[model samples]
Target: MKKFIGLMVIGLTALMVLSGCGDQKEQETSSGTKETLTVMASGVKNGTQGVFLEQFKQMVEKEYPELTVETTLLPDDQYLTALKSKLSTGQAPDLFLVQPKKASANSVEELAKAGYLEDLSDLENWDKIKDQGKNDMSFEGKPYALSSSISVLGTWYNKDLFKQHKIDLPTNWQAFLAACETLKQAGVTPIVMGDKDSFMIQFGMYQVAANQVYPSNPQFDDQLYTGETKLTDDVWVKTVTMYNELYKKGYVTDKSLGLGQPQAQQSFVDQEAAMIFDGDFSLTAIENDNFDLGFMAMPANEEGETYLSAATGAGYAISKKSQHKETLKAVFNKMTDGQSEMFTNWLATATSFTTYAEGDDLNPVFEEIVPAFEAGRSFYWSNQAWPSGTETEMQAKFSEMIGAGKLKPIDVTEAMQKKFEELTK
Candidate 1:
C-alpha cells in the first residue's frame, strides 16, 4: 500500500513536470526591484535537476523581494541540441548545463577554463561549501557549479523478496550464481533491467567492469585512460566474464530488452525481480513503487574486491553568450539557495550523499552501502569517465559479445583494450 501511494505520487510528479506544464513556464511573478531573470534548465522531468527548478519557484522566487526568475526546460537527450543553438547565438540562457562524460568532457573543461561557467567565488557561502563541493561538483579549485549532492551506486534490491525466497544476496561470482538459481527455482527473477535505454545496459556493464578494472583505489579508470595500465590487464576480462555469466544464467530480466524505464521498472515494483543495479536517481522510482529496497555492491571478485557505481551530477554552466554577467551572478546566487535546499532534500531521500558539507540526513538505505563503497576504495563509471562515443562502441560491443556467445572475461578485457585503442587513435 505504501508503495502504491508512493508510485502514484512519483508518476504524477513526473507527468505534471513533463507534459503540459509548458516546456517554458514563466510565472507572472515579480520582484519589487528591476531585476528579472530568465533561467534555462536542462530537462524539466528527468534527472533531479528539474526538482531544483520546480522547488526554486516556491523557495527562492516567493521569498526574494528583489529577484524574479523564469524557467525554460528542455529534454536531456535534446539538451545539447538546444544548447548548441542557444550558446552560439548570444541570446542563450542565463544558465545552462554540463555533466562530465568521457569524450566531450575535455570540451567542458575548456568551457569552464574559458569562463563559460559562472564563478560563485564571490558568494557569501562559497567558502562554507567548498570543502565538500569543490572537487566533485566544480573544477579548478573553484565552485563553478555547486554539486548540491553526489552519490555512490551499486546493486539496488528488495530485501523482502530475498528473505521470503530464502535466497542470500551474492557477494562473489559463484555465490551470485547460486543465489540466482535459488530465485529461479522459486519463480522469481533475480534481476530487473531496462535495456531499452542503452545507458541501463551500459551502467550494468560499467558497474561489473569497474570491479575488475579498479579493484582497489582512487585510480579507478583514471589510470586506464592515461595508459597507466591497460584494459587487456587480466582484471578487465574477468569483469566482463562475471556479468555475462549472470546474463547467461537468466538472472537479468528478459523484459529488459523490450522495456524502457517505466515498463521495465514494473518488474521490480511488482516484485517479479529481486534486484536491479542502478544509481541513486532510481530512488524516486523505488519510493514510488514503495518497495523495501536494499542495496549492495555488484558481487565482488574471489578476493573480496569490487568496483563502484558512481558518477557526478550534470553541472550547471553559464551561457558562453550571456551578456548579463553581473545579473547572472545575482540570479545564480539565488539559484544556489534553491540548489542547496533541493540538493539536500533530494539526496537525503534518495539514498545518495552530497559532496556538499551541509548535507541532509542520510537515507536509511545509504547507511548500509556507503561504508562498503568507501572501505573498498573502489570507483569508476566508464561512460562518465571516458569519451562519449567510447561508451556507445564499448557497450554495443559488449552486448554483441554476450549475444554472440563469445563474451568471456578475457574477451571483455581484450575488447576494452581494442575500443580504448580505437578511441584514442
Candidate 2:
C-alpha cells in the first residue's frame, strides 16, 4: 500500500509538470511575457517605409513592454518573391506590406484571396480610413490592409525653369502642347521619359486615361469584369493615341527608349528637361535644392476638366498565420487613433497627401493640384483595378509601338484586352 501511494504521487507530479510546459508553449505562441512581433516590407532601410516601421516598432515596444518588434526591409525586386515564399511555407511574418487591390502579387486582394492575409474589417479603427482608401484596401467588401497615405500621379516640373521661360502652367491639352512647343523652341527638352524602363510608360498613360476614360464612366473596370465593356473600346484607343502623339512630336527627350528611370530623373534634376511625368513616390528622386519643384495634374482634358490619377498608398497587412494577431491588432488600432504619437509621426513622414483628416498640410510641391484631389476630380490608378499582369502587357505592347514602330494604338489596346481576359479568366 505504501509503494502504491508513492507511485501515484510521482505520476501526478509528472502530469503537473507537463501541463505547465504546455501552458508556456501556448503563451509563447500568443503574446507571452516575452514575445517578438516580426515585420517585413519592401524599401530601403532609411526610406519612407523604413521610417514608418521604425516608428511602429518604437511605439509597439513602448506600449507593450514585454513585446519586441523586429523589422526587415528588402528591395522591391526581391520582396514579393520572399513574401510569397514565406507565406506558402507558413513562415510569413506577423505583418508585412501589401499593395491596394490587385496591383501586385502581394496586394491585399490577391493575398486575401489566397488566405494569406487576415480579414482586418473588424479592427476598431477601420472606419477611420478614408472611403476611397477603404475601397482600395478591401476585397469583396472586407478590409485586409491599412493605408495611411494617398499617392498622386502627375507632372513634376522645374519651377525655376518655368519662371525663367515666362511660361504659365497649362490647364488643358491644347495649352499643354503649346507650352511644350514653347519649351522646344527655347531649346529645352519639354518632357523626358524613361521608356527603357517599360513600367514608366504607365506614369503618363494612366494620367491620360484618368481624364479620357474614368470621368465619363466611373465603373469602366467593373464593366470589363462583367463583359459589359472591353479595353479595345474607342476610349482606350483615344487615350493611347494621345499618349503616342507626345512621342511622334519629338516633345520627349531624344532616344528616351534607351534611358532608364534614374537617367531620366537625373536629366530633370540637372535642368536638361523641363518636366517629367511621375507619381509622388518620385519626389525624393527628382527634387533638387538648386531649384524649386512644382507638381500638377497632367492636363489631358479640356480646360477645367483635367482629372488627377491618385490612389491609396501601399500599407501594412497582418498575416493570417501570425500567432501574435491580437498584439498586431492592438498596434494597428493605436496607429489609427489620430491622437497617438504613432499617427503624428506617420503624418510627418508622408511624402504625399495622407488619408487621415489630421493630415491637412499638403506638400509644397503638390500644392498646385490639391484642389483637384479635394474637389473629387481624381481617379484611382487604372492598373490597381485590373489583374497584376495587365499593366505589364500594356507596357510591352506600348513599348513595341514606341520602339519598333510596328504596332498602332488600336493594336496595343487589342493586345491589352486579350491579356486582361487571360488573367481575369
Predictions: Cα RMSD each: 7.0, 12.2
- The residue pairs in collision within model 2 are none
C-alpha lDDT of candidate 2 relative to the true structure: 0.78
What lDDT score belongs to each candidate, Candidate 1 first?
0.57, 0.78
In model 1, what is the error at residue 390, expressed in angstroms?
1.3
Off by over 4 Å in 1: 1-36, 44-47, 54-70, 101-110, 130-132, 288-291, 305-307, 320-351, 358-360, 373-376, 403-425
How far does residue 215 in candidate 1 sit from its true spot (Å)?
A: 2.8
Candidate 2 residue 285 Cα shift, in angstroms, is 2.3
Candidate 1 lDDT at 299 equals 70
For candidate 2, the TM-score is 0.87
- Give the TM-score of each candidate: 0.78, 0.87
Clashing pairs in 1: 3-290, 6-288, 7-288, 98-315, 102-386, 102-387, 103-387, 103-388, 211-307, 237-409
